[model samples]
Target: MNKSYDLIAVSPHPDDAEIGCGGTLALLSEMGYRIAIVDLTNGEPTPFNDNPQVRIDESLKAANILGIERVTLDLPNRELLDNIEARMKLAKVFRKMRPKIVIGMQGMTPKASPDHYQSQLIFDASVFYSRLSKWEHLFDGMKPWRIHHIFYYYTARELFTQAQPMQFTINISKHFETKKKALLAYESQFRAHPSYNPPIIEWIEGMGRYFGSLVGCAYAEIFYGSTILELNLFKQILG
Candidate 1:
């Protein structure tokens, strides 16, 4: 029997999903939604860390912190590309897991890892490829599954913002601390290590606060989607 998920987040690496949408994931899981994060790579061989298992362990810890499942693929870390192999691997997951919603990382990070941009391309393709009819042989004969909704999360690594057609923020006031704790679980990446020593936690908090202020909340996370969003305007405005 195949496993199922209500939502699956595609991350270029372990910490991306945590940094981008941990609060939202936590809130949704609390609401009894089946959510998971799929890391495209182990995110190893960085300046500070050489051990891949450490990163893997950190990712699992973060997943536990946010009450979500995690899956790490065997793709290359820094050398990730939007090729057939990568697309098929992710599409296969979409087929097997059968998520109704898929959230992916958006934007190109020139200063950061190029894998982010490649991840975006790969994610877009996998969503399409996952629903193809005659790709049974490539995906080990798994049935094609069409995801119902698509959303994009930002890493906040870019210096400038790219205007998206459908952008919105979710109130994460109650779950902001959960998101912070999850990101802190990635000690190898955020802590004062050999080389990577940035005020990531502080930065993330600031970003969350800024976005929250725009929506009159204590904390919030931003997301982009192509699908039209339908909501009760009066309830939102009065709340």
Candidate 2:
């Protein structure tokens, strides 16, 4: 709420954004876009991460790696509910940040985490509610704001067999290493996992390369959007 952001990425937990779209975020940040991440939860109560403060610190580290701001909501993890209250809370953030574009997780997931879908619902509702003038009182005196676009990023654990096709791919080959550094900030979640047989970072990098192959890049991240994106200039689409 300190300053307006050009983009805002909403994450179900502290590390979700880093895992999902860190490379894109880093690229945007490097391009001088004011961006921030809103974490729905501190991502606590895990098998390795019991202390909430540690997770918070790790999230800040990740945000630093991406050179963006990070905000954490006080919603309960693993039991996030997509209700009016949650929508209102996120709407306030939307109004405060006044982002031109908003990004969030794809609601359709065959995974066990209800938090992911709930977070998506909250983001979808909040984007609409933020534009309502009547919600001025609810948003703590902030003016109504409308987001121009919404994009969805994928997480590594999603059941890709039933996943939706990506609308576009961002060539993050230049920023893939930066993304890995940001993800590694979550030591408790990745490095400290009990069954850390397969390195999560390696798998994520491999996935990025695989996605890049589809678009003839070294490494990339995929995104989906319901609305068609209009290109103003041919040069913009070249990159």
Candidate 3:
């Protein structure tokens, strides 16, 4: 069993983590890579679950669907700030997960909530914090995690299109539906919500198909990276 991971998806909110790399996570999981998804918040300001407890419950249910390690920072919606306390909490998780690759939102917004930017900041901080020697407490016996690569996943496609140097894209057509199913686990955010006037499923599929077309597929997930991408000498290609 290949328990070691090559990549990890980081998100500030419940759905953000899954949406950005759910298909890739699933595909990689099938291929035996250990994948971890971090959910920084409980998806607060949520219109559906009037009670705070219910939203937390829903988030956990959704995490179970993804099938890997997960964490909830429980940060308030639209009020996240970059601070030492918050960074340390995230850093600890990074030390434990110890992934080789990291990806998260670029904090792009049109009519976006503060959560969008906060989420991105968390990813950036975690990526760097994990490598710092100053943070000796995050890991057992001060073992630092040095990630090899980092990428920014576009936050809101309806508003922002990052012209970042494109490294590669995951053709999600084959398992895009699997990703959607995992998303559907967040029933509270969609069906359970009072103002879910527009079901999330429709938007997810629309974006999936839209992006998938970019790489000659029925559905695909896109990612932009700073470092160059290299196909392993023995890499098994995926459709």
Q: What's the TM-score of each model vs. the native?
A: 0.95, 0.91, 0.85
Best candidate (score: TM-score):
1
Off by over 4 Å in 1: 232-239
Number of the candidate with higher lDDT, 1 or 3: 1
- Screening candidate 1 with a backbone cut-off below 3 angstroms (N, C-alpha, C), the clashing residue pairs are none
Please give, for residues 1-239, the per-residue lDDT of candidate 3 as tens digits.
12445677777777776777788777777777777777677677666567766766766666566566666776666787667666767776777777788888775665756667766777777778888885575455546778888987654445565567754678877677778877777776766653654656777788778887776788877778877767673555442
Poorest 10 consecutive residues by lDDT, candidate 2: 157-166
List runs of model 3 lying over 4 Å from the truth. 1-5, 137-141, 155-157, 193-195, 230-239
Better of 1 and 2 by TM-score: 1
Question: Of 1 and 2, which scores higher on lDDT?
Answer: 1
In what order do the candidates fall by TM-score, top score first?
1, 2, 3
For 39-108, candidate 1 gives per-residue lDDT tens digits of: 9999997877778899899899999999999889999999999999999999999999999999999988
Q: Which stretches of candidate 2 lie over 4 Å from their true place?
A: 160-166, 194-197, 232-239
Candidate 2 residue 101 Cα shift, in angstroms, is: 0.7
Clashing residue pairs in candidate 3 (N, C-alpha, C atoms within 3 angstroms): 48-193, 212-220
Tens digit per residue, CA lDDT, model 2, 127-147: 999999876677778889988
